[model samples]
Target: MSPVSSFLWTYAVGVKVLLSQLLSRSFSLPVFPLQNGKVAIVTGGAKGIGYETAKHLSRLGMHVIIAGNHENQGELSVSRIVKETGNEKVEFMYLELASMQSIQQFVQHFKAKNLLLHVLVNNGYIRWPVNQCSPGAAAVMLVPQRNTADGFEEHFGVNYLGHFMLTHLLLDTLKQSGSHDLNSRIVTVSSATHYIGELNLNDLQSRHNYSPHGAYAQSKLALVLFSYQLQQRLAAEGSHVTSNVVDPGVVNTDLYKHTSWLFKLCKWLTSWLLFKTSTQGASTVIYAAVSPDLEGAGGSYYVNGQKVKSADISYDEDLQRKLWAQSCNLVGNPERHQCAS
Candidate 1:
């Protein structure tokens, strides 16, 4: 997209987000008073909106487990939340989404705890410089082609595939929890950038053509697609575990740490003018996880605690199905084993 076009599109989306927040301000988020027995796992809960999300969920009296790669930061986050919320159930578990082995290990450890999971928040992401190795490379060359330890594109692997595996691995527990209350949920944190992404099923990792923005957007789109598809499968199997996506509008977070100095300066200058606070950005996630109005509501996109229509492409069932099949294959689900309830 051209500079002017990009700017205008961003401005329009920002206005819409602000309006949504304004309209929903009077709607008080429901508090879960009987959440003492419930459990929630939030990925990337060490910092940014994820940290705030973990804090909020713990405040509701739920047993919250924060999974992230940073050991010290994760422990610190767990300590702070426990001190603030006085919910000692909050704990941190090590997880590196860039590696399949790490995701499996984390899931295995959680399962060994023998706790029923009421919510799974897939909220972690990374944004690296597309051409950090060759800073002077051309635009195409600047596209991030880096792969994860699993040999998948870094963004795709961490943002979409890893969560995909984690969710499937824990599906049984989520279903077991829902058997008692029918309110278990899987909340996938997506972004408005999904609208700008072009899903190339043939080249999901972007081996042939790549752009940093395109790869990031594609990962988010894949997340939404997975959310919808998962919801559909759950419904078809007569399960009550709902799956939904959230867009935390333009928050100033560490996700942009890899940006250029010029971009950083510009963001600092416009931070208050454009960005949402981490707490504000996390509100939608909390809403999706516990909102009474959303009980059993699946396959929806939410912003600022309200159900909102997603990008045009997000409604394409064919695209959603294709992405789901490809994701299963990439994750080694060759037989397409139905996720156990």
Candidate 2:
């Protein structure tokens, strides 16, 4: 997208978020009922909306694992949330989403504990500027390096594919944990930018032409597609698990730390008016996980604590299946049955 278009689209999204915040003034999700034995894994949960979501779940007596690559940040976040919520079950686990091997290790590590998982928040994300290296270091920062440790583009690799691999590996645990009353929840964080994304499945890696904006948008769109498809398969098999996607609205977070100085200045000046706080951004995610009304809800897009329609293209069954097959191939054939069955 052109700079003008990016700005306009961003502005429009900001306006919409602001309107929702104003109209819902004084609105807040009630404290979820205590969930003593439930377990949740929140990827990228070291900070921002992910951190807030973990903290909320912790306060409600759920065991919350904050998964991410940075050991120090992850540990510190665990300490802080545990301290604040007085929930001793909160802890940090290492999971690098940019590496499929790392994701596999994470699931293995979790399974070792012999615990059941009630919620999996695929919330870890890399910002848009992996291509932007420090001044005079552009040579080593070529586009291929922009691809993840695996060969996929970083946005798709970390943001979408890594989570895809994690979900498939853990689906059995999620199925076993869910019950007739409380379905297991798979929540993938997405964005409104997905609506403008033009996916070129023909060039999923953006090898011919690459743009950070387009790549990020495509990754998010792919996430929603995966989520909807996962729900469909689960429902067909008479499983108790549910999968859904969420757009947290524009929020002030580290996700914006890589943008240009001018963009940062504008955000700093207007964030209080236009942006959702990380806690507010996490509301819908927590709702999807524990809300009684949403126990069996699946294949839905959530915004601001409510269900809504996603882009029309996201509803395409053929497209969802095609992407799922391709993603399975990308991740490897060994794990296909985890999602397919």
Model 2, C-alpha of 199: deviation from truth (Å): 1.6
lDDT of 1 by residue, 1-341 (tens): 43345344544554565555445552345665556788999998878888999999999999999987766667888999999999999999988787888888998899999999999999855322233432121211113468878899877888888899888888888988896355799999998877766688888987875656667677888889889988988898888699999998877777665444655686688777656788888988999888777888889998767788988888888888888877777877722466322
lDDT of each: 0.78, 0.79
- The prediction achieving the highest TM-score against the true structure is 2
How many Å off is the CA of 51 in candidate 1? 0.6
lDDT of 2 by residue, 13-38 (tens): 54666667666652378767888899
Find the 10 residues in a row with the least total lDDT in model 1. 134-143
- Measured with C-alpha atoms, the lDDT of residue 65 in candidate 2 is 95
Query: What is the Cα-based TM-score of model 1?
Result: 0.87
User: What's the C-alpha lDDT at position 29 in model 1?
Assistant: 58
Question: How high is each candidate's TM-score?
Answer: 0.87, 0.90
RMSD of 2: 4.2
